[model samples]
Target: MKVYIETYGCALNKGDSYIMMTLLKESGHEIVENYSQADAIILNTCAVRLETEERMKQRIKELRKIGKKLVIAGCLVSSEPALVMNLAPESSLVGAQSVDKIVEAVESPTRRIFLEDSKELITPRVFEGKISIIPIADGCAGDCNFCITKLARKKLRSYPPRSIVNAVKEAITNGAVEIELTAQDTAAYGLDINYSLPELIKDVLEIEGNYMIRIGMMTPELAMKEIDDIIEIMKDRRVYKFLHLPVQSGDDRVLKLMNRKYTVDEYKQLIKEIRNKIPLVNITTDIIIGHPGEDEEAFNNTLGLIKELKFERIHLAMYSIRPNTKSALMPQVPDPVKKERMRIANKVYEDVAYSVHSEYIGSNSLVITTEYGKKGSIIGRTINYIPVIVKDYNKLGDWINVKITEASFFDLRGQLIQ
Candidate 1:
């Protein structure tokens, strides 16, 4: 059988698609490049936000017109399986938890099936031939009022430190330059078994991987608990110096309403401590504007903090109320208000992004070459996770020194220092 996979949502989703492809191949199936040529079409859907879900719906509708024997498998199928069935009646449904069962779905004649529970099968996957993204854990216990994903994901369960180490070992052996450790919350890793992120990293680093490990996004609440320990552990040569902490809001009232345990002030203190100790560390965060009950003052407070922090990257998303989440029932934020607030957040981010990026104009950075840019430019990212576009491939994939000649808010243009 030939199968085609379409992935949406975060890096995790992409990782799942890769795993599915690899598993299918191992299970006597061929993975096709195009849906038109495949025996089946599988959409690894994402429902992170209302807009993303709508886009998935739109894609499903369009694909159903031409894509035959469709399979809807991802967070969307997990969270709203019935809705997916309603839309694509003939489609098979699978959830994020059911990622390992993609081959069965493709071969079976089932109309709708759910296989989303418990994770830890040692599924090591590499995405886009560039990096390895391994799921060291899955599910998040954090019950943020605005999150629907939390509901869909089962529980926080971290794989044994040795398991992750083995996966990274295999990935490195496969010529992966990067090993990305991901989950709903990397900070919550091992809490179920009384282990911690630091312990996990130490184990993985000992696996003798030439590739670098990029720790996925972590909440400040969990990360701040053992900041010292985390810093010490992450200093390993294999670990990248990038930390992504999501701060949904910068206002206490809004934070409380959103069920976020930490106040804006507490999050800021964590940020300050981390940056104070690790100067030049790349700090990135997620900001969700228009979360229920977010007022103008709250929004501005967020804006103020963004200005102060000057994040290397800001993943700003307009609040999208998911069904069954606590915030969705609270006074509905007007769509127009959400749009305006998103604009404000984006604008603030734009200015800081370009301005902060400009400082590297004359500095040299170690970039992992990913793609070639137009007109003699090759693109990669710094150890700090900032995108740098180099004019030539002194080499791609291998780390190379780039002296920044010009910088933009979103990317940097550099010349090969060699």
Candidate 2:
């Protein structure tokens, strides 16, 4: 069977897709790049927000018209299986936890649904390029009122340290220079199994490889517990000096309503400690604008926090109500208000980001070429994971010195230096 797999959402979902493809191939099925060339189509969906959920629904409808054997996979299947079934009753369903059973769904003649919770975390043997995304754990410890993902992935399940280390070793051996360790909350890893994320990173670092590891998003409460160890491990040259701690809101009242575990002051102190230790660390964050209970003062507080912190990168999104979430039951913010707040927040982010990137101008830094960029340029990243686009260099995964020449809010442009 020729199977085409399309993945959406976070790095964890992409890692799951890779595992599914590997499993299918091991079962003697050919994986096709295009849906038109496949006998079956697997749509790995994401439903973190209502807008994303609607997009997934529309995508499923279109794929059904392709008339191929359609398989709905990922969080959408686990969180809203009925809606997916309603859209395409003939489609087979494979939940995020049941990724290893992809072959069964493809080969079985009868329509199938594999939504049962499983603790197994399968590692993929095949990786696509110099970058490998490895899911170290699944689910998270947080129960944020606005998060629908908690409904999909209900428990924390961290993979064995040996398995993750082996996976990282294999990826490096296969020419991968960058390994992304991802999870719903990476810092929450190993809490269920009595191990810790710092321990896992130490194990991976022991592997003999010339690669950089990019740790994924972490909840502030969990991260604060191991900040010392995390900072110590990040001092190694092999680990990227990047930390993603998402502070969804800035107002204490709003934070309480959203059920966030930490206070705004605590978040600020965490940032201060990290910066004091790793001054050059590129700290990225996420902010949801106009969530339930966010009024004019609350929105301004968020804006003020952004200005005060000056995040190197900000993933700003307007709050979208998800089905069955606590925030959805509360009084909702108006759409027009959300839009206006998002606009203001976006402008602030752009200005801050551009200023951050502009500081790199005229500086020489060592960067590892990772991927190709727009037109005839190749993109690389500094030790801090700041993207530097260089022209006339097609080599991937090679370390080179670059002199920063141009900057934008999105990325920086550099010239290869001898």
Best by lDDT: 2
Model 2, which residues run further than 4 Å from truth?
A: none
Cα RMSD, each candidate? 1.7, 0.8
lDDT of 2: 0.92
Clashes per model (N, Cα, C within 3 A): 1, 0
Clashing pairs in 1: 354-409
TM-score against native, each model: 0.95, 0.99
lDDT of 1: 0.82
Candidate 2 lDDT tens digits, 28-140: 99988999899999999999988899899999999999899999999999888899999999999998888877888999898999998764788876778789999999899
Q: Mind giving the per-residue lDDT tens digits that candidate 1 earns over 87-172?
A: 99987777888777777788887675866573445465445565778887778868888888887676777778877777777777
* Model 2: per-residue Cα lDDT at residue 53: 92
